[model samples]
Every structure is written in C-alpha cells, then in structure tokens.
Target: MNQDFQEAVRDTPGGTAEGQVAVVTGGANGLGEVIVRRLHSGGCRVAVADLDGHAATALAEELDGTRATARGYAADVSIRAALEQLLADVLADFHGVHILVNNAARTQAKPLLEITPDELDAVMAVNFNGMFNACQIFGAYLAEHGYGRIVNMASLAGQNGGTATGGHYASSKGAIISATKVFARELAPRGVTVNAVSPGPQDSPMVRSIVGEENLESYRRTIPVGRLGNPAFIAEMVALLASPDAASVTGACWDANGGLYMR
Candidate 1:
C-alpha cells in the first residue's frame, strides 16, 4: 500500500544495483508501478513510460521529489516508432540504460469461442508485439553495452491456457515465453540476460479488471496460498533478475503463482 513497506520487504538491502539505470514500460500502475518503486528503493535511476501520460508524469514526479533521477514518458509500446523514441528519451535522461522491464501488456476476459478477430489482434499488438519491439530495440542497446538485464512480465495463463484468461491473452503470453528464450539465447553472447516472470492472479487492477470483484472470493479459494499474488512480491522477483547477481540466470521463466500451477 505504501512505498516504505515495499522498500522494507526488499531482499536486496542496500539496493540491488545502486546507480544503475532502468527503464520500465507500463510503469505507472499495477505491478509495473511497484517494480519501478522497488527498483528506485534499490538505488537505481528509473524511467517510467506508459500510455497514460498524466498518470506517468504523476508517478515520475512522485519519485522525483527532490532528486530527478526518475522521469516519466507518454508512449504506446504497441507502436514501433514510439517505443524507439522512448528508448531515445530515456537514454538522453539517464545517459545509459542497464536494465529494461517489459511490463506493458493488455488482456481481456472473453470466452474462447466469443473472441473476435479484432480482439485477438488488439491483445497481440500489446502483449506480444509491443514486448517484441522493446526487446529488439532495447536488446540492441544492451548488446552494444555488452551488459544489461531484461525482465519480461508473463502470466499463469501463458502456461495453463485458461485460468479465466481469454485465448488471445493466453496465446500472446505463451509467445512471450518463447520470445524470452530466443532473446536470452541471442543476447547471452553479448552479456545481456533475458528472463520472464509468470505470476498467477495478482491483487492488482489488471487482475481485478479481468476477474471482477464478485469472482475474486472464488478465485482465492483455488489458490494454494489462499490469496492472490502481491504486486510487490512480483516486483521483488524482477529486481532479483535485474540484479547483477543474476547474471548467470537467463532464458528462464520464474513462476510466482502461489503454487496454483506448479511445474
């Protein structure tokens, strides 16, 4: 609920990678916002980019306070050119990017048979296409730098194919899992690690939007942990993956599903 609580629970005490610069897409809200805040608590300069320009600017200002290490940008990740410009702006502000969190995604809760062609396209454009663009563009930057960390946000639906997620959303996340592997394999040689975090129904607006408040009680009963996932917990995993200590961990999909879908 508060930044202080999130910061206190962090496993990395003095911060994961102090002085490092990170770029987080969809960083204005939900898990993305928590991730941005967690990273900042770890002493990393961050850039928060989101389609909601107002919210993004507000978040940036909240973090900026006295120091201006964190800045927000209004950009749609689905657009290739816009993402390119976002990378440029972040670079200009931070001077360099050492970590990238591909957290921007869109999803809906339509039945498999009810999903329209346009619906599939729209979800893919953000969930898959947007992630791809960021990886390729920022992946290039990380490669050139010969050192960087990339953490892609994935979901339980990607592995299970249902879990209340529509077919389009599930498929897009599955593709992201595969893409993470591809990026890891290609970028590892260049000293960049690409990993993904697949979390089960989180206690975030995104999950509430899809699952609805009325059904949350039933959903909780199904989770082995007896509760929905926490955004901060997910953020902690991202921080660990982004940290220098995780340099050897790549091409991996870390699960944070509360034993709901264990491998």
Candidate 2:
C-alpha cells in the first residue's frame, strides 16, 4: 500500500468508511454501479472490481476528484487466484479494507432438466463460490482489524424457487443466503456484520436481458408495486445494511422485492 494512500484512508472521517476503502465486485454496471455510486456518495473510497475493467475505470473517473476516491480493477471473481491478487492489490492501495460487497453474479435461466453440469458449475462458481472466497479472504482481514461490514447480494429467486431465474441461478442465490448466516455467525464477535439483500426483479440491464423488452411491461404489471424495482431502490437497501445504523442486523436476509415475495 502506498504510505500516502494509507494515511488518507486512516485519516478518513469515520476510519472504516469515512474515507476508508470498500470493494464492490461486478461494479461496472447495473445494480453494482448503483451500489458503488451510493457508497461513494456516503464518503467511502471505493474499488470498482469487475471483469470489465474499462467500464469500471470509466465509472471511477466519473467519481474521481470527489470526497470518495474510486479505482478500477479487472478480475474474474470465480477464479481464486484472481481474487487473491485483487484482495492483495486492494490492501496495498488502501492499507486495509473496511467493507466488502459480494455483488458479482450471473443468472442463467433454463429448465432444470435442460441445464448442463458445466452450466450449473459456472453459476455456482461465480455466485456462490466466489462469495465464499471473498468472505474467507476479507473476513480474515476484518477479524484482524476488529470491524467490517459484508453485504452479499442475493435474489428473490432464492427464496421462492425462482419465478424469473430458474435452476442454477436460483440454487446459487440460495447458497448465498446460507453463506450469509454462516459468515455472520463466525465474524460477529469480531465486530464484523454479515448480511444479504435479496432483490426482486429490478429495472437493470440484467433484468432487461433476462425478461426482454416485449415482456417488461407484463412483468411489471405482475408485481404488486405495478413496476419493476429501480436500481436506486435496491441501492438504498444495500446502503442501510452496510451502514452503522444497521449494526444490530447480521446473518439476516432483507427482501427488497416490492412485495413480490413476502416472508
């Protein structure tokens, strides 16, 4: 880590996130982008880690020269070696990590019978195993530091056996929910809180790609709220879960589904 950067992070208003560092995977676009924006606005220096480094860098530049500094790193969350390097780089740049948002995921919807082993494995690797890897690596750092926040992005599909995303995607998200509980249990005593945000269908690029433009209107009508959720709405939920106000919240799954799934 650069000594100057470390000093900057240490001197951050609140220490943990006032200017402290946060890592957001899949932060180039869609819900990830919204989350990054919200965290930046909250005065956190953010590392936008994504497979698409170009887009991530662009977003960083957009937020540069502000109270919150942003950096872009290209990484494939599914690969352990890549994640190891990503974490090391983040620590080197910021001196220490305070927050981690495991938001990288892929939703490949297909009938259960039609899904191949490779397909299932790929989804599991990114959505579930990727989160596991992050928690293991960063969770250790958080425990050492004695404070941290982790918000895993899950989906309504995980809870309801999936209305939109079927098979592999749903299973992977279910695993995310389970992992959140396990992580919270293990890290709570260290002042690290782990939680999950399971969002319903949102107006995101992924949603548009999955639902299609022709069916978007019909899908919106099906939700009780009469509209697909916006990225900002989901971002608000994430912000709250990641904030000190939610200190008592851990090992919990929050449903931001516009009443689509009530539990």
C-alpha RMSD by candidate, in order: 5.8, 3.4
lDDT of 2 by residue, 123-240 (tens): 9999999999999998988778777789999999999887467688999899999999999999999878999999888887778889899888998988998988888978877777
TM-score (all chains, Cα) for each model? 0.91, 0.90
lDDT of 2: 0.85
Clashing pairs in 2: 1-92
- Tens digit of lDDT per residue, candidate 1, span 1-263? 13432332244543366677888999999888999999998888888999997898899889986546788899899899999999899878777788899999887778888999999889999999999999999999878867889999998899988737788989999999999999999999988999999998888777787778999899899899899988899999999999878979999999999897888
Q: Candidate 1's error at 194, in angstroms?
A: 0.2
Q: lDDT (0-100) at residue 134 of candidate 1?
A: 95
How well does candidate 1 score on lDDT at residue 88? 91
RMSD of 1: 5.8
Query: lDDT (0-100) at residue 127 of candidate 2?
Result: 94
Give the whole-model CA lDDT for all candidates, comma-separated: 0.87, 0.85
